[model samples]
Target: MIKFFKKRPPANLPDFWKTYENCFLEKQPEEVNSVRFVVLDTETTGFDYIHDRILSIGALNLINKHIAINQSLELYLIQDHYNAETAKIHGILKNGRGTECITEIEALKQFLAFVGNAVIIAHHTIFDINMINQALERHQLPKLLNKTLDTSTLYKKTLLTSNVFKKKDHYSLDDLAEKFDISMKDRHTAIGDAYITAIAFLKIWTRLKSKGPLKLKDLLKLGS
Candidate 1:
């Protein structure tokens, strides 16, 4: 099932995106450290957009630079199409094979409830977002209402200004984990990578807002 946003923009989305821009109306805090962010990911069967199936969604909530392991969401989904090759990458088994599993609808409902108007952050956000949107489309739920940030973008801001320390075209979770010295014990799980991105997002927030006002507008602008 694939869900598309209603043809008209939701009140929260600007006239630009047309799925409800109003959701963004809530005033963001004046400081960078005071925001609530949802860091998340999906474990899928493979790379083919049409052939793949999302096996899981793992997410954690961060508030004011703090992460509470207890305040996280981990949902395993039932898969109709399972790929054996990628199992080594994500480790999710098909056919009710996981420790705990839920249907796509169940996972979507839980994710919506957990996110509830918070901004979402992820590394290489487009892939995860596309996977989620596909799932949402399949479920016929309204499209996501929250704003999004990508750690791949945030991490770049932390580099030095000199041309000597030139930044790369793209940054990976492994690169940041190595650079920041964050633990990699949980490497590929949705929840684990989310934790890494959350920390990286926090670090970037600290570096960028260290000498600035750090308004909500500032964060939305980070995408540009």
Candidate 2:
């Protein structure tokens, strides 16, 4: 009789991945202020998760309402897939002028190391996370295990629900930046957007805190 066996993770997984996986073994902090958050952004060739490629990834650490500028990560990836039209938006040329581009594997390694087990924050979290997950799948690696928060959704929670003020079903990153008075000097770039997201999150956190004491789980529920 013939039988099919389930595939398993390769025993020879990279050291970096093992290190990242190890981070989850420790319990996460319950208090929102005590937890480490990684706010990140990705510049991609297009929105198609299956076909598009990540042009660059940018991330920064936030803890206790403080953004750790020194603990920031910016990585440009080298890929044969290049879309001229999309390049017009992100402004990353095939041969990035002065940017040092690395392989997808290397970028994943660096990203996993920088992210650790921190909660992830992004404007529209699903797209960014999916793009990164696709890259990981290409390398036969597991998807990211970190919890994620969407500023777009969380921002909506901060708004007052009244007959006079009807909230839109969707809020763009630009809307949050404008509402929070964050600068748009660096809009399209990955790192620039990450910085904007971080500030927007801070504003949202403040507003939510004003409503009541917010725990990590409560914030996640609001975003969800």
Q: Pick the candidate with the highest lDDT.
A: 2
The C-alpha TM-scores of every prediction are 0.84, 0.94
Tens-place lDDT digits, model 1, residues 1-224: 99887586234433323323344677667665677888988889876555577888889988888897899999888777878889978877666363677788778777877876778898988888878877766655456767788888877766777767878889999998987889998878989888888887777787887867677768877842
RMSD of each: 6.0, 2.5
Compose the digit string of candidate 2's lDDT tens values, residues 116-189.
Answer: 99999999999999999999999989889999999999999988899999999989999999888999999999
Error of 2 at 21 (Å): 0.4
Model 2 regions lying over 4 Å from their true place: 1-11
Candidate lDDT scores, in order, read 0.77, 0.94
Lowest-lDDT window of 10 residues in candidate 2? 6-15
